[model samples]
Target: MTRVKQQKPAASPAPAPSIPAIPKPDVPARLAALPGLPIGELKAEWRRLFATEPPPYNRRFLESRLAYRIQELAYGGLRPETIARLDALGEQFDGRNITFRRIRHEQRPIAGTRLIREYQGVEHVVTVTRDGYEWQGRPYRSLSAIARAITGTRWNGWTFFGIRPRSGA
Candidate 1:
């Protein structure tokens, strides 16, 4: 029998190295605080929308229901200047209490007439349109539409419907 030569173990290749994955912080939380639509884009869109669509509503143009009721009374014709002033009151009072009044002419019946004014117990002259709902002869959709024209913001509809108070009011 021939003598067997001692066999040496071959060096094993180094085990493959392992890599660790890095942890990442959550991103959605930070973005959540921002408005979904960018401010610039919203303004641009609003301008475009209003420029193309005719204004269907304007508080300055809408004759309140009370005003329309008062206009039906005797001696209802109003001067142009008075009409202009009353229209601007929406912007000033942010829609104050509206009222209707009867002015009976005890002495001069020709000059005396009923008056309808926004806010309680005011003598302001507010003329109502035939349908009693037009702004600058154009149909108005809501008091909020008028508010949008004046304030450049989306106002809640409840206020115009006379069902709810303004957000802060």
Candidate 2:
């Protein structure tokens, strides 16, 4: 009677597989390829800006764009009409597309007027600097320079382009 019941063996559980940790960003690409500014100057300013969060005028955008725009303004200046157009656009960049790197701080700075341009395809981040000017930061000094970096190719994001008035007035 004791041996009447048949015993069943338990199934073994599967072992968990290991996952890899996130890789660190390539410092060279991050530091080397600036849109229009000199490498040394950009490095110095990037160091200064990164330590602190985006100031008033930069706060509106995500951390990366805000950081990027600060670099842009150091090289190029924005245009007055562009600023007016942005206001008129009121969150619209032409009828079909729109993006923003807005001022999101305790007190936004008055840019007076800042130019906006589409370099590769995306909206180039533009902003006014403390010394009073606009700037752009994308594409690096050369496409080769950008290619040598992590992307292994040219970056197609916005760049600091010269201001051109909208025609057909």
Candidate 3:
């Protein structure tokens, strides 16, 4: 009988260390829980989600930002086109300059809004238009002009109409 050298069976390769699959985050639940989380917990969550330190903002700000971040991570962020459009719009208002001058959209009422103000004993109605303001069927370039025509005196139109003061007052 020829002694055939039989090679021992090759040792089986060690199985890869079993890695526990990370669970998908439940976005809605996380968002809902943000409001109730304590400040320290909220900061912890912010750090975990953003991988950075939380901004030194108010509780409401942190909660709102974290909620947005949670949803963004789960469902993906804004589309590129949307982001570009937002940047373009912001540039229009920001002027892309160091001395930033923001156009106060909130202070200006929407076009077609009828501003009714009583001057002395008479009521005056000014209609906001796309180009400017329409007062008594006449188009005025500036609210101050309209205010002057209404009261025969110089006045800050926004203040006169009870709109919030300008950025620098």
Candidate 4:
């Protein structure tokens, strides 16, 4: 007959250190007044927050950006690495030196042009309109949105529809 000894149970883990909480900032009052603000006041507010000349954007653009800046200051901005990656991606698509204004002003396809792609046995069609793209008689902000609707997943509309070549093709 063999005798067995009882083993001791393992010890419990130490308590984790508590992290300090970051206090949220109050919402800027300017955000509420944005809709009615004139372009000059918006520009001045942009200068006050950013400490630089405001980009030559319209009133609505200035208001939205200033609102974002206020929130960004209260919270924090994207990490440096994230911003770097975004910059690299923009450079990959366009040149590193390319400005957004140049891209926005670039010519678009003629208003009457149509894009067609067949997926899952259904032919999807999109039309280029003066302001944006249209699909199935509904206006869309981007082809990606229409592609998502068709594929039930996110996709780069231009690449999915063959407007732009596939990565290797």
Candidate 5:
């Protein structure tokens, strides 16, 4: 009688490596003291954390940036690819640098800037102010309202005034 040897089963594939968890840092309460800090003190705090001179901006701007920097130091900032993509997007938009916060707000024409449009063979001019747009010597809330007044229908002011590119463009 021939005795057969038992064959071992094939080895299974190795398991994937698990990612490690990141530890949270103990942030100082001073990070939250934005509103009350004086302008000079806020800039000093920014210099201490960033090791660079702060921009010449208002107190609220300085505080918000300092808070963001503090958090970025604790957590990771944007990836290089994401930043590159954003830079490309900024260039696409008339080669202007775009910040993350700027995306949250609508683009505004500078004060004293004028926007002209023609609707139904009539000329219309709107002047941008520090607070809002002025049309026909009347202060209005938004460009859309101005556009609606001009077209007698719903319209986006920026699009109507060529501030934004046309659709499909």
Candidate 6:
């Protein structure tokens, strides 16, 4: 019986070496390096982290947001309750809540604080009260009213008093 030579089974390929994962740097180290990174590098980082194109905002904005994002990723995002609370608060300001009235609480000067202004070489003092402002022994509902009383023309009370309006008001 002529038996055909049986071919030996091909040797299996050796398993590839397992490369160890490169450990991520600590959060603080990553954050500390943000300011020094070039803009291109920052954008690259943003793309890698967000998996999208970086915004067209300025460098400072990118840095600040990236810093926050880095920390957020390292730890965790806002709690669900906190996010819900923020969304509800946002709804109040976005005109979605029909009964919501914009309260100028932050715009109002603290009660009992004295505001002094000089117009036409005369010094005027106004006291901030809980309900309104007091000027020359008269309660005024708004600083504009007080300013109008001081200056014969309509003027922005904050501008007249050199009080810069709070940003994002």
Candidate 2 segments exceeding 4 Å error: 1-47, 50-63, 91-169
Candidate 4 deviation (Cα RMSD) = 19.1
What is the full ranking by lDDT, best candidate first?
6, 3, 5, 4, 2, 1
Off by over 4 Å in 6: 1-25, 97-163, 167-169
User: Per-residue lDDT of 1-169 in model 3, one digit per residue for the tens?
Assistant: 8999999999999765432222246766777788889999999887777777899999999999987777777667799999999999878875674223332445567889898899998999999886668998999866788899989999988778776644744
Task: Say which prediction, candidate 4 or candidate 5, comes out ahead on lDDT.
Answer: 5
For candidate 5, write residues 1-169 as lDDT tens digits.
9999899998998765432322345445657577788888898777777767889888878888887777776676799999999978767764453331342234566678899998899999999876678999999868888999998899867788888633442
Candidate 2 or 1, higher TM-score: 2
lDDT of 6 by residue, 1-169 (tens): 8999999999999875432222246787988999999999999988877767899999999999988888777777799999999988877664563212333657666899899998899999999887778999999877888999998889977788887657887
Rank order (by TM-score, best first): 3, 6, 5, 4, 2, 1
Candidate 1 contains a number of clashing pairs equal to: 5
| Tens-place lDDT digits, model 1, residues 1-103 | 9999988899899865432221223223222322444544433333332333223444322223213322322224467888889877643543442311111
Candidate number with greatest TM-score? 3
The global Cα lDDT (0 to 1) of model 2 is: 0.41
Worst 10 residues of 2 by lDDT: 97-106
Q: What alpha-carbon RMSD in Å does predicted model 5 have with respect to the real structure?
A: 18.2
Extract clashing residue pairs from model 4.
Answer: none
Query: What lDDT is obtained when candidate 3 is compared to the true structure?
Result: 0.78
Among all windows of 10 consecutive residues in model 6, the one with the lowest summed lDDT is 94-103
TM-score of each: 0.18, 0.21, 0.47, 0.41, 0.43, 0.46
lDDT (Cα, 0-100) at 95 in candidate 5: 40
Model 5: worst 10 consecutive residues (lDDT sum) = 97-106
Candidate 5's C-alpha runs over 4 A off are 1-25, 95-169
Tell me, what's the RMSD of every candidate? Answer: 29.3, 20.0, 18.5, 19.1, 18.2, 17.6
- lDDT tens digits by residue: candidate 4, 125-156: 89988666899999986777899999999998
Residue runs of model 1 more than 4 Å from their true location after superposition? 1-132, 160-169
